[model samples]
Target: MIEQVTVTPIAPPPAVPRASTWAAELRATFTLAWPLVIAQLAQNALTTTDVIMTGWLGPEFLAAGTLASTFLMPFLVGGMGIVGAVAPLVAQARGARDIKAVRRVVRQGMWASIVIAALLVPILWQIKPIFAALGQNPDTTLMAEQYIQIGVWMLFPALAIIALRSLLSAFDSTRIILLITIGGVLFNALVNYALIFGNFGFPRLELRGSAVATVLTNLLMFGLMLTYVLRHRRFKRFNIMIRFWKPDWPRFREIFRIGTPIGLTVLSEVGLFTAAALLMGLLGTDEIAAHAVALQCASMAFMVPLGLGTAATVRVGVAYGRKDAEGVRKAGWTAFALGTGFMTLTCILFLTAGPLIVSWFLDPRSPANANALGLAATFLVVAGFFQIVDGAQVVAAHALRGLSDTKVPMIMAIIGYWFIGLPIAYVLGLVLDWRGVGIWLGLAAGLGIVAVVLVARFAMRKRLGLMAGLG
Candidate 1:
C-alpha cells in the first residue's frame, strides 16, 4: 500500500547554514546536544525513580520490579529502535526538502509503533507462564505479573512519545521534548511518592503503585506531546493529522529495515552488560557488588556521550540528506571530539576520586564493606580508563546510524562484545584470575575494537547512501 500523507499548510524549516568549520559544526551540534543530554538524564531519572521507590517496599517488591523490568526492557528498547528510524528518515527528508516524505515517515512510524505496541500486550499480559517456564519462583512470578499488568498499559503511549520525539529531533525541535521530559520527571516523582506511600490519604499501593504512576505518567506525556505536535504552527505543516490512519506499507517496511538492526544493536549492548555482570558473580558477592558500583558510575557518566551520539545522529543524517560529505565528516568529528574530550575529563575525575566515588555507593564504615569498597574503587579506575573508548564507539556508531549503515555495525557490536570481548574476559578474568579488573579490561578492549570497526565503516563514503533506496 502506498503511504499517504496530507501536506499541511505550514512552511518548511529554514535551511541550516552549511557547517564549514569545526567551530561552526560544534556550535550547531551542541545547539541540539544540551537539550538532548538533559532529556536523556531526565529519562534515566525516571528509571531511577522507579527503582528507588520500589526498593522501599522491600526486597520482594524490588525483585518483582526487577523481573518485571527485565521482561519489559527488551520490548521497550526494540520498539524505540524500530521507531528510531523515523528521525533519520525525517531528517534526511527535511534536508532534501521533501516535506511529504517527512510526513509519511512520521505517520508510518506511528502506525508501525501502535501495531507493535498492541501485539506486545497479549504477550506481556500472559508472561507469568513464561516466568514459570523459566523456573522462576512462583510467588515472584505472580508479583511480577501484577506489576506488569498495570505497566503494560503504558507501552502504547511510551512508544508514541518515542516516535514523536524522533520526528521532532529530525526537525531540530528538541527543547519541547526536553521540557516535556523534565515535566515528566517531576510528575513521575510526585505520582510515585503519592501512590507508593499513599501520600495525602491515597491508599498505599507500593509495588502496584509504581506501575500505576508509570501508566499515568506515560499517558500524560504522550497526550501532551501529541497535542502539541498537532497544534504547533510550525509542525502543523507536516499534516500529521492528515491521513492519520492511512496504511503505507513501503514506508513501514523501511522503518522496520532501518530500525530492526538499530534495536538489536542496542539489545546486544544491554546483553553485553548482562554478560559482564554474570562474569562478576563468579568472583564472589563483593566482586559482583563492586562491579555493580563501578557499572552504575560508568552508566551515569555515559549519559554525556550518549546524548552526543543522538546529536551526531541528527547532524550526520541531515548532512547525508544534503549530500554533503564534508559536512558529515565535520559533524562526525566534532561530535567525536566533544564526546571524547568530556569523557576524558570524567575519566580523570573517576581516577582521582575513586575512593570518594566508591564511598558514595558503598558504606565505608563497616569492615565487611571495606573489601567491596576497595574493589569498587579499583573497578572505578578501570571504568575511568574505558570511558574514553566507550564515548568514541557510541558516537561513531550513532554517526554511522545516521547514514543508515546499521546491519554491519550491528554485526560488529555482536562480534566485538560477544565474540571478542566475552572470551577475552573469560580468559583474563577467570583463567588468569584477574577477577573484576580482568573482566573490565576485556570490556574496554571490546569497545575499542567496535569503535575502530564503526569508525572505519563511517569512512567508506560510498556505503553511506548506497542503501538509501533499501531504507
Candidate 2:
C-alpha cells in the first residue's frame, strides 16, 4: 500500500510516428496528382479552344487574341498566385485539426481575391492605351482591346475559382475540379461555335463573341463551383461565407505576404519566356513557328509536374502543420520522385518522337512547312534535356511553398531566369550565333541551376531554420 501510494505509473515511450512508407506515399501522391493533372489539361484545353476559334476568324484575330492573352495572363496569373496561398494555409489548418482556422483562411482568401480583382480589372480594362504605348499594331490593338474590355470581367470569377479550388484540394475533392473544368471546356466550345460564327442564331460577334463566351463560361463555372462547396455535406459545414463581410486583417495580410512573392516569381518566369519569344521573332517566321510548336509540347508535358507540384504543396503543407518533420520529408521527396519520373518519360518521348510530335502540330508533307517542321523537331530534342530539370525546380519550389517559403525562391527565380538564363540566351542565340538551339540550351541551363538550388534549399531546410515552426 505504501509502495502503491508512492509509485507513479511509468510513462510510455513517445509513440513512433508510423511514418508512411515510400510505396504508400507514392500511391497517395499519385492519387492526389492525377485529378489535378487532368484538370490542368482541361484548363489548357479551354485556352486551346479559344485559340482555335480565334484562328478561324483570321490570323489578325488570332494575333489580337494572342496579344490580349499575353498581356492578360500576367495579371491573371499573379492574382491567382496571390490567392493560391490559400492552399497551403488550408492544408496546414486541416492537418492541425483547426476547423476554425480553416474557415477563416478560406474566407480571407476570397476577400483577398476580390480586392486583387478590383485593382486589376481597371488596369486590364484600359488595354488599348497600354498596347499603344508598347507600339503594337493599332488595328490589332484595337481588336484586342475589344476582347479585353469584355473578357477582363473574367478576372473576378477566375480568381474566385482558384481560391475555392484550394479548399477543395485540401479535402481531396479535386475530382470536381476536373469535372467543372471539362464542363467549362465543352461549354466554351459550344458557345464559341455559336457566337463566333453565328451558327445557332447567336450574334456574329467574332473576337468580341469569343470574349463574351469566355465571360459566360467563367461565370457559369464559378457558379457551379460555388454551389457545390455550399451544398456538399462535407464542405457546407465550414460556412465559409457565413460572414463574408467580416474582416480578418491578419489573415488577409498573411495571404499577400505569402502570395506576393509567388506572383513576382511567376511574372519573372513568364517574362523570361516572353523575352525568349521576342528573341525568336528576330530569327525568322519559321523559327518563331517552330519555337511555338516545341514550346507547346514542352508546356503540355509541364502540366504533369505542375499538377504534382501542387499536390506536393498540399501534402507537405499538412505535414508541416502537424509538426511532422519526417512526414514533410517523405511527402516532398515522394512528390519530387513522381514529378521527375514522369518528366523522364516525357524527355524520352521528346527525344524519340520529336519528328512525330512536330507532325501533329504541322503537316510534314507541306513543302512550305518543311523548314518549320525540321526546326521544331530539333528544338524538341533540346526541350527533352530541359524537361527533367524543369520538373525538378517547379516541384521543389512548391514543396518549399508548403513551408510557407516564397521570398527566397522568388529571388532565386529572378536570378536564375533573368540574370543567368536570359543573358545566356541572348549570347547563345544572337551574339554566339547559335540561334534556336542556343536559346534552348540557355533555357535548359537556367532550369537546371534553379532546380539544383531549390532542391538544396529543401534538403537543408532543417539547418536553415525553415522548419523552426515544427512542434
Candidate 3:
C-alpha cells in the first residue's frame, strides 16, 4: 500500500528593483563574509606564526617546516573539501526546515572525516621515505619527519573543525567560529614560544615544539566548537548528536556522492602547487624557501576571497533550496564581485611592496637568506598578476557547489592544474631555464584559464535558470 504523492508548485514572487536587489545581496554577503574572513585569516595566522618563528631558527629549519606544511595542507584541504559538502547540504535542508536531514548529513560527514583521518595518519608516519624519494635533503627530511609524527594526531580535530565550521556557516552562525580561531592564535603563540625555545622551564624541542603547539591548538579549537554546539541555548532544539551511533546508508551515500567530487577538485588544485613546491626543492634550499615565503604571502591574501567563497556556497545553497533563482544569481555575483575587488587591492599591495613583504619572512641581512628574499619578491609580483582571477575562480566554484554542481568543476580543475599548469611549469622552469618566475607564471596561467571556464559555466547555468532544481 504505497502512498502516491502529489506535489504543488508555487510561483516565485515578483522580482525586486535591480538596485535594491543588488544592495540587499551585497549587505547579506558581507554580513556573512566578514566573520568568516577574520576566522580564515586567524587560521592562516597559525601557519604564518609557524613560518615566522621557524624562520628565526634559520633557513634549514624554515625549509623543513615549510615542506612539512606543504605536504600537510594538500591532504588536509582535500579531506576538508569532502567534509565541506556538509555546509551546502545542511544549508539547503535548514532552509527547507528539515532537521532530520541536517542531522543525517552531519553524522555521515563525521563518519567520512574519521575514515579520511585513518588513512592520513599512516601517510604522515611514512612521509620520510616519500620525502627522500622526492629528492629532499636528508637532514631537513628527518627534521620534518619528526615534526609530522608528533603532530599528525591534529589532523582529525582539524577535519572536525571544518565540518563544524561548515555546519555553523550554513546557519549564518560565524561569530563563534571567528572567536574560537582568534583565541587559538594567541594560544598557539604562547605554546610555540614556550616549547620551541624552552621558555618557562619547558623543553627546547625546536621544530618539534612548534608541531606540538599546532597539534594542541587544533584540538582546543575542536573541543571549544563541540562544546558550544552541544550546550548553546540557541542550538538546543537542533540536537545534532541525538543519534550518536547509527548507520544510514542512504544519507551516507548522499554525502559521499557530493563530497567525492569536491575532494577531487581541491586535490587537483593543491596537487599543482604541491608539485611546484617539490620541484622547487630540487633547485636548492634558497629556491624552496623563496617559493614557500611567496606562497605564504599569497595565501594570506587569498583567505579574504576564500571566506567569501564559503559564504557564497551558503547563500547560493539556501537560495537553491528555496528555489529562488534571482537570489541565487545575486548571491553568486555579489560574492564574485566582492572577492575580485578585494583581490585587486591586495594586488596593488603585492605589486608595490613585493620585496619588503618578502623580506619579512626571511632575514635580508643574513647572506644565506638574502637570495630567498629576492626570488620571493619576483614570485609575489607574479602572485599579484593572478590574484583577481584566482579569487573569481574560487568564488565561482563555491557558487556552483551551492547548486550541488561539483563534477564538472572537478573535471575542469584536473584539466587546468595537471594537464595545463604542471607541464607549463616544468617546461618554463626546467627546460627553458626560467626557474621560479617561470613556475609562478605557469601557475597564474592555469588559474586564469580555470577562472574563465568556471565563470562561463556559471553564467550558462544562470542563462538556463537555476530556479529549476538541478538533478
Candidate 4:
C-alpha cells in the first residue's frame, strides 16, 4: 500500500475575473456618445440657422420666432418624449436578444408618434389665442401664429424621426442619423437663404420662408432615415414596418404608460423655459430678443449633454436588462462624467466670451442691436453659472429613464421647475423688479434643485431599492 501511493495532480488556479475600469467605461461611453452628440449638434444647427437668418431680418422677426418656439417646443418636446420611450425599450430588447420584441415596440412607437402629432398639431394651430391668453405681445403673437401654422406640418415628420431615430440608436447605427441631420442642416440653410432673401430666383418668404424650409427639411430627414432603416442590412432584418396597420394595443399603451410621464416631465422643464419667455415678453421686445439669443447659445451647448444623456439611457437600459448592476453603474456614471465635463468647458466659454458669443447673434456695431446684444451677453453669463447643474440634471434624469423610472423624476421636475423655479422667477423678475437677470437666476435655482435631487437619487439607487431586481 505504501509503495502504491499516487501523486495528486495540482489543481488549475481559479480563473481571475476581469474588472471594469474607468478608462474602459469612458471609452465605451464616448464611443456611444460621440455620434449622438454630433447628431444633436447638427439637429440644433437647423434651429440655429433659422435663428441667425431671422435675426438678420430684425429684432421683430427674432422675437416672433422665439415666441413660436416657446409654444411649439413644449408640444414637440412632450410628444417626442413620449416616443422617446422607444429607445430604452428597444435597448432592453436588444440586451435580451429579443428581436421580435424590438420590432413590435418600434412599430407601436410609430403609431404612437402619428397619433400624438395628429392630436398636438391642431392644438399648435391655435397659438395666436393661446399666446394672447398668456399675455404675449399682440404683434409678436400674430407673427408667431403665422410661423406655426406653416411649421405645424413639420410635426408629423418630426415625431416620425424620433421614433426612427430610437430604432437606429438601439442598433448603434447613429452615424447615419448624424449624417442625415447634417444634410437637413445644409438643406435648411440653403432653402432658408434662397427663400428668405429671395435669392436663387425663389420668391422671398421671410419668416414664412423659414417655416417652409423647416417643413421641407423635416420631410427630407424623415425620408432619408426611413430609407436607411428599411434598406440597411443591420436593421432591415427586423422588418420594423412589416405589419404597418396592425394593432398592438399593449405595446402602444406601454409606450404611453412609460412615456406619458416622460412627456409631462419634458413639458414641465420646457414649459418653465417657455413661461420664462413669456415673462421676457412682458419685459419688452428687446428683452425677449436678447433672451432668445442667449437661450440659443445655451441650447447649443446643451445639445452635447442631451446627446450624452440619450446614450446613457440606451447603455444603462441594456445593462439593466442583462441584470448587470455593475455594468449599469459604469454606463450611467460615465455619462454623467462626460456630460458634466463638456458643460464645464462650455461654462468657461460662456463666462469669458459672453460678449463675443452674443455678437454672433446680433451685429454689435449696429446701434439697433446694441441694447439686445448687451442684454444677451449678460444673460449668457448667467447661463454659464447653471451649466454644470443643468448638464447633471438632464443626464441624471435620463439615467433614471434607463431604469424605466419616469414617474418620480416627472414629479421632481414639476416640483423643481414649476413649484420652486417659476415662483422665484415671478417674484424676482416681477415682484422684486429684478427683471431679466432675476428671471435667469430663478432658472438657475430650479435647475440646481432638480440636479441635486436627481443626482442624489441616482447615487442611492441600490440602497434605495431601485436596483433590487438587478444583479
Maximum-lDDT candidate: 4
After superposing candidate 3, which stretches have Cα over 4 Å from the reference?
1-20, 462-467
**Number of backbone collisions per candidate, in order?**
0, 0, 0, 0
List per-candidate RMSD values in Å. 4.0, 6.8, 4.0, 8.6
Flag regions of model 1 displaced more than 4 Å: 1-12, 55-64, 122-146, 275-293, 358-379, 424-442, 462-471
lDDT of 1 by residue, 88-113 (tens): 78877777777778888899988878
How do the residues 191-228 of candidate 4 rate in per-residue lDDT, one tens digit apiece? Answer: 99998889999998888999999999999999999999
Worst 10 residues of 3 by lDDT: 1-10
lDDT of 2 by residue, 117-189 (tens): 9999889888788667755678877887888988889999999998899999987788999999999999999
- For candidate 3, write residues 96-122 as lDDT tens digits: 556666667787788878889989998
Residue runs of model 2 more than 4 Å from their true location after superposition: 1-19, 56-61, 126-140, 281-289, 362-375, 433-437, 469-471
The lDDT, on a scale of 0 to 1, for candidate 3 is 0.85
Better of 1 and 2 by TM-score: 2
Candidates in order, TM-scores: namely 0.86, 0.89, 0.94, 0.95
Better of 1 and 2 by lDDT: 2
Q: In terms of TM-score, how similar is model 1 to the real structure? A: 0.86
lDDT of 4: 0.89
Q: What is the lDDT of residue 185 in candidate 4?
A: 96
Relative to the true structure, candidate 3 has a C-alpha RMSD (angstroms) of 4.0
Q: State residue 115's C-alpha deviation in candidate 4, in Å.
A: 0.4
Between which residue pairs do clashes occur in model 4?
A: none
Candidate 2 Cα lDDT to native: 0.83
